[model samples]
Target: MAAQAEPSLLVDYAPVMLWQAGPDRARSFFNQPWLDFTGRPLEAELGFGWMEGMHPEDRARCEQVCQQGFASRAPFTLDFRLRRNDGEWRWLLETARPLCQDGQFTGFLGSCVDITDMRQAMEERRRALAERELLLAELHHRVKNNAQATTSFLGLQASRATSPEVAAALRGAATRVMLATLVQDRMFRIAENATIDLGAELLATAQAAVDVVGRPGIVIEAEMEPGLLLPVSQATPLALIVNELVVNAARHAFADRPAGTIRLALRRPAPGLGELMVADDGVGLPEAQRRNTPQGCLGLHLVPRLARQAHASLRLDVDGGTKATLRFACG
Candidate 1:
């Protein structure tokens, strides 16, 4: 191995600014980088002179942390703004530790790292996040108002319909729209964290659909596994798919029956994957309808497209009744 470089020479020319202060809390040494950073000579920065370059706002806090460290003879870290040689203020993160010789307290040694760019980037990120939250809140408020207005208009139209079937159809449409709006409101409630518990949302959507479409004798129930945490992107399409499925089952599956049962289930069956099943114990799908899929039904039409958006596979089981199972990525 080659000879070790001089320790003092390395400290004097290190990339970061380094300094030392005596036990009296009076700075006694300044490395070349520290002097070059301030564009000042060693004598000009010795003792309490180095603090002259620090921002006025930071001086008191810096003094307090430094004084506390000095009094306790412990290592400490602090952040402050200091003036550069170019007269620009930059953030400096200072870390200092007590120095000892022969187990006896001697002085304090410290290093300063320029973190101005990092701090600025972090501040910009925080600002952008706040703006996004405000926009989402406004969107949620507008959607809620629009849903209520549309539901009321549809209700009025249903009341004017001469036929009960037409009135029921209009009410179902209103329910679907309101379901979307309500789910969005819930999503925005937790949007600040950019995550959603998808299972819970599915259960809520299923229950709401039954409340809207159920008659006196109809029963709609849901079995949902909680803690299916997923991103916001997954929430929208999945919620849409579930809402459409439930609404479809309630309207068409039980179209002829005075009362029936619709069951909804959600589970995280495997890692990075979620499974959702909507089954109705009512009239099964017609052979042609099951074979060709419902081209005329808007809800069924949207189901396949929504499944694709959610990156989920759709399987229809029309054994005794209509059962739609969807498996999608949760990660």
Candidate 2:
């Protein structure tokens, strides 16, 4: 008969480390490449002896996974650290599938590849992401502090101004700046996904604007739809628009009354559209001002500009006090 080649020769020269484990979940065979990589003799690596080269922390888990996979006769993959010939621990990715002959499960055929470099790169990338998040949070904190300082300085300047018009202008500027700061603070505090809760943001901004005005008799109530979320880009402009309208209501709407109520409502009135209504039960706007003209107070001028920026329609109703309606497409 012709000389017969050894069955092991087929896989001994393969690039990956090939192995086989018997049905008992103990290693039965280690190819030449595997044995050479571990620098161990066949007698020393057969059966469960190969586990000695696995990291101590990973050995138990690896054995448990292998046992489960063997019991189920299914393919499985795992990663672990193994000692190489040079005594250095290297990461390895091992994948194994059930072996069967004549429809009877016999053992597990497995292959392992050195993945130390890939694991190191992934770890570095994770560290870089963590560092970036930390830096962004710190930057937001500094911005908030600077905004607060600037608001305080503006308040001081407003207090010292001799003319009422100049003082009012300074106060308005300070309030606008504070509104921007509130938006930034809220953005930084939210998750990295960058979705803003419209109701919460509007409530906070309205409350802050009310507090700044310090009107004891005037009550500002917000009736917003729950869980209205918008991206940062939309939220910022929408917040500024609401801030202007709310402040306008507090200042001009209830001038003659000792006590009044300002109701701010935000709702999704239609699909892909949002509406905001600022209504007050105080003095209504004058006929000329109600016409949405650019020739009016700072709030009137600002409302139109902000509405334009947000792609919203601005309408003023003077029938029952002053109601400002802003409808915009949300899509």
Candidate 3:
């Protein structure tokens, strides 16, 4: 007589649903958990009857995958919605492997776990992330608009100033505010990570500063890599430093010359290092300032402070014209 199957050999009392199939893809056994979950008896779940409880949208693909796995006699996994005993649909993760006995292929064994709650939780997290990104973008937009409005107010104040020196100082302040505003604007347009394209932002801000100055013969040129990215923390200080250097050049560098060219260039000279240069073909810095004292030039004094904030070294050279260089850690 054939040996009786051990109780442990059967999955009938297991918590999870389990099944066995014959070599011809005919159901041979369904554990108690499987029958209870589907609310079906042994006869109703035989052969292809189990497919009746699968969601219609998942049936075709599930069958195709099953056929492929069976043909290859390899372990496989699939996810689909199955109708529960309470008439509710729940997601399930089903895994199956070829079963062998007596050194020969006999059939397949499969197990399934309900993953409806996990799947729903994952979907909720995804939606929440998307909503947070949208809200952040909107906040950046509003901040940028407010900053630009402040810049305009400063411009009006500068226009009404009686002294040329006071007017220039107010205009410089307006440009500084605009620098931060530009950064916010770029952040709003980019992805959720809040990284700004350093080169592009610099080029745009330089052009805007020049336009605000309204110097008839001064031209701004940019030579920058296409997509040099920097986080806002680094970009803001670096941008302010550049704003100061460019404005300083436009104001004093070309005082005696009829026309001048101010060039802004960004280069990666070494790994983890970046170089930003502003060079102008105009009268060089005053002899006293070239000595690095920067007496009476408020913007020039602010340069060192801004460079320190960006963790960069600032250098000024007067060969041919003034060239301001800022070297910082980029990576």
| Candidate topping TM-score | 1
Output the worst ten-in-a-row residue range by lDDT, candidate 3: 183-192
lDDT of 2 by residue, 152-242 (tens): 9999999999999999889887887887687667766766657777888877887777777777788878899977777766677777877
lDDT (Cα, tens digit) per residue for candidate 3, span 1-331: 9987777555777778998998888888888899999998889999989989999999989989999988999998999999999999999999999999998888899999999999999999999998998888788778878888988998999999999989988888887777657655654566645777799888877877677667878888888976677877788778777777777788788888767999999989988898999899988877878844376677788888878888988898999999889899986
Instruction: Return the candidate ranking by lDDT, descending.
Output: 1, 3, 2
TM-score of 3: 0.68
- Cα error of candidate 3 at position 106, Å: 11
Q: Scored by CA lDDT, what does every candidate get?
A: 0.85, 0.84, 0.84
What C-alpha lDDT does candidate 3 achieve relative to the native structure? 0.84
Question: Which residue runs of candidate 3 sit more than 4 Å off their true CA positions?
Answer: 1-46, 52-78, 83-90, 93-121, 194-197, 220-237, 284-311, 317-320
| Candidate 1 C-alpha lDDT tens digits along 1-331 | 9998898899987989999999988899988899889998999899899889999999999999999999999999999999999999999999999999999899899999999999999999999988987887888788799899999999899999999989988887787788878777776667544888787778777777667765656676778887888777777788888788877887777878788888888888889888988888988877766842567677887888888888889888888888989898876
Error of 3 at 90 (Å): 4.2
lDDT at position 287, candidate 3: 81
Candidate 3 Cα deviation (angstroms), residue 46: 4.2
**Comparing 1 and 3 by TM-score, which wins?**
1
TM-score of 1: 0.88
TM-score of each candidate structure, all chains considered together: 0.88, 0.70, 0.68
